[model samples]
Target: MFQGMPLAGAQAGGGIVSLIVPLVLMVAIFYFLMIRPQNKKQKQRNAMLNQLKKGDKIVTIGGLHGTIAEITDDVVVLRVNDVTKLTFDRNAISSAVSRETAVE
Candidate 1:
């Protein structure tokens, strides 16, 4: 038999709650510092993809630049040159460049 030992581990000052508070704060800090901005950027990218239309200039993930000649539910026809047209998935378009931005 153990003689005169603290009956519970919680006898340590600021037991479970003190241990848990810092962990919760760390998770919250990570959410704000890392996760939130990533989610916001992804939302902006999704919004841009949805707003794509014919005649919009886009850059593909592969770094190829083209003008959208046609659009469908899942495909885009990009005219890279007078004689070069390529079909790509809508997701392959990385970003769009407006005439104003492209000229600058």
Candidate 2:
């Protein structure tokens, strides 16, 4: 009697593929929008950290600004003032201020 109608128990329209396509698209969008840019920024930050040298003025994650006096594999000694120096982790550095950039 209902030959033209879909059965309630039928497998239905687009099966597993339909459900998966949107999910894959969502993951792709998330990676492109969020993950990829974040990874790129992290790599740039790592390169900047690796290039750190003595006398480079840097800002720390805590917003403290100082010039690098000494650096080891994992430690950074900042000369905050003539008699004030502080030690921090290399990773604690947020950004470095180049001499040219500082002059501007």
> What TM-score does each of the candidates earn?
0.85, 0.85
For model 1, residues 1-104, the per-residue Cα lDDT tens digits are 77767668656566778889999999999999999999999999999999999999999999999999999989999999899999999999999998898742
Give the poorly placed runs of model 2, Cα more than 4 Å off. Answer: 1-9
Q: In terms of TM-score, how similar is model 1 to the real structure?
A: 0.85
Best by lDDT: 1
Candidate 2 has an lDDT of: 0.92
lDDT (Cα, 0-100) at 96 in candidate 2: 97
Q: Candidate 1: global Cα-lDDT?
A: 0.93
